[model samples]
Target: MKGEFMSLILTTILHFAATNIDDIFLLLTWFLQRDSKLKSSHIIFGQYLGFIALVILSVIGALGALIIPQEWIG
Candidate 1:
């Protein structure tokens, strides 16, 4: 049980990092830019909007995967 739990946690972390690595670099670029017009609030709000959209899409995809017949996928 503990081993399974650990594997689940590790897998989740790896998947999350794999997916978000690009987002991390994008966020860093946004933060490092010196443009006076680009406010931190704008960057933060955009990030939140993007994160919410990704989560919503991920949920939909997971639900679809769960509902669909496996043989149909092949």
Candidate 2:
């Protein structure tokens, strides 16, 4: 059971990194800007908020698809 849980976590991390590879570069650039008004806290908060919104929307859409008919989806 423990091994299965660890494998699930590792898979999730790998998939997340693969899909959000661009976000890594984007965050790096934001941090590198020396004179920018954006603080690290602001950047971090915005990223978290954006990710949460994405997950919520994805969940809602998936649930909706399951509730709706296939003919209506097309």
Q: Which candidate number maximizes TM-score? A: 1
The 10-residue segment of model 2 with minimum total lDDT is: 30-39
Model 1 ranges with Cα > 4 A deviation? 34-36
Q: What's the TM-score of each model vs. the native?
A: 0.78, 0.72
The true-versus-predicted C-alpha distance at residue 10 of model 2, in Å, is 6.6
Tens-digit lDDT string for candidate 1 (11-68) = 9999999988898889899999937899888999999998899899999998998899
Q: Write the per-residue lDDT of candidate 2 for residues 1-74, one digit (tens) a residue.
A: 99999999999999988999999999999888735578888889999999999999999999999999999999
Residue 40 lDDT in model 2? Answer: 89
Question: What global local distance difference test value does model 2 have?
Answer: 0.92
lDDT of each: 0.91, 0.92
Name the Cα RMSD for model 2: 3.3
